[model samples]
Target: MSLFHFSIRIKSSRLCLLNIKVYFCFALAICLLGIKAEVRANDRYEIVINTGVSEKALSVNSLRSIFSMHLKTWSDGTKIRVFVFSDDDQLHQNFSKEKLNVFPYQLRSTWDRLVYSGTGQAPIKVNSTEEMLTKVATTPGAIGYLWRADINEKVNVLEIK
Candidate 1:
């Protein structure tokens, strides 16, 4: 082949490689941004309660007490019924750690102690997100945690201090 043609071919291949690099860099940047947003999504959970309850927010400690079944009644004298997912559930783990600053095992230990001691009761365990939403909606003064996306008009999102 002529030297001229050979040089042109080399240039074209170099251009193609450069294009691939640029494309990949753009893709990598987009992926990084998406990962940041996904992390925020992972943290998106809300403390929800039945609308009949008057309180709109709670301190983290009070929230912990409620979930641990030590706080049995809402301030308005409405019975505070607590709901939860099973200990092994991912949502349960996240909520326990992030919101309550406790592990699932710790919450479980507290609940078990409450139950066996006969002075208190454990929270109701819901099987799925749907069951959680339904129970919290139907039961007055009920409290539970749910992913923000699954939340609807049936319950009020309780703010945590």
Candidate 2:
């Protein structure tokens, strides 16, 4: 090949390599985003109770009853004070849907019916996750939901069987 053609071929080869590098970087970014999303999706919340409480594990049905205000006390007869975030809160909504198998609105309806009918009371609503963690960690007989990242050593995570 002539000198000019050789130089041209080298430039084209370099350009092709550069294009491949760009495509590879783009694919890597997409893969990383997918991985991040998967990890985030799996980072779910846990049902937490005060450290002083007696229970270590609870059945899903019983947990539902507690949040629904049907079960008022623990098995040991201590008053179970349930704490929750606002109905629209994402963590609260996820906990209600995933753990209780009910939507947040459904939980509100149940609490409202009980409260208005003079059968039971609603949960104590907090403003933020920080408040939730603090209240549940400090108060005796307190039960609430918290994101796994927000959980601290002061609170006990209740296992739902």
Candidate 3:
């Protein structure tokens, strides 16, 4: 009877340890999920360009010129081609207002006029930052904007002042 009681006590202790471990694992999982959700919430924009781009820091005016097709090349002789996110995207609205100093609607109307008049082509609109980054990375002379968190080794970042 004594031996049996000892064995039962050991089993109960083991069960208690197992329960503690399970609770620890559950808590850890919840913490990790919270961290991931917070990371996803802090959205920021990035300026991405082709590998060969020379201009590292561009003024708002210069960026505007490049996107508006007023400037065609860098000082190093690389041709410039700009890409833009769709009008509905937050990045597009923020970039237009903050960097381009224009409202999203006004910018779209101006781009349309430029396209229709044959004066300049509108920047190619991409659906997402990931798509923009992939295309800009692969295509020579391509430049686009994306969320900063989405930037990766595939594309080079340019500073917009």
Candidate 4:
């Protein structure tokens, strides 16, 4: 083949490879963005309280204390009923780590110690998410966690600061 033709072929081949690389990079970026969004979605949850509770918000420490069974009553003298799923539950694990800034194992240990020592009581454990919603909605001064998608008007989402 002529030198001119050979050079043209090489240039076109390089351009084609460059185009493929660009497309690959674009696809990778899209996949990464999708993964990041899914992770953020899975982490989304709300701290719900019974509508009768007077408090609309709580500090982070107060929330931790309530779940740890250290805080027994609300500011208005109403009993604080805390609900929880099993220690191994995904939602529980997420709440412990993200909201309470503690691992699930650590939270479980604290609850165990409280109950064993007779100094405190562990939070009420509900078997299913539906029951959690029902109990928290019907019970007075109840507090619990729910996936953002599962939240309804029956319970109030408490703000944590």
Output the number of the lDDT-best candidate.
Answer: 4
lDDT of 3 by residue, 1-161 (tens): 99999999999999999999999999999998875211223237777888877678889888887876778888788778888888867777777766677777887887789889998788787877677988899878888887777888888888877
**After superposition, candidate 1 runs with Cα above 4 Å error:** 1-42
lDDT per residue as tens, model 1, 1-161: 69999999999999999999999999999998875211344468899999989999899889988888888888887799999998988788788877787878888888888789897898888999999999999998899999999999989999888
lDDT tens string, model 4, 39-113? 344358999999999999899999999998899999999999999999878888778878898888988899899
What total of clashing residue pairs does each candidate reach? Answer: 0, 0, 0, 0
Local error of candidate 3 at 13, Å?
Answer: 88
How do the predictions measure up, each by TM-score? Answer: 0.73, 0.73, 0.68, 0.74
lDDT of each: 0.88, 0.89, 0.80, 0.91
Off by over 4 Å in 3: 1-43
- Give the per-residue Cα lDDT of candidate 3 at 14: 100
What TM-score does model 1 achieve against the real structure? 0.73
What would you estimate as the lDDT of candidate 3?
0.80
Global lDDT of model 4: 0.91
Q: What are the RMSD figures for all models against the true structure? A: 9.8, 9.8, 14.1, 8.1
What TM value does model 2 have? 0.73
Could you tell me which 10 consecutive residues in candidate 3 have the lowest summed lDDT? Answer: 34-43
Model 2 spans > 4 angstroms off: 1-43
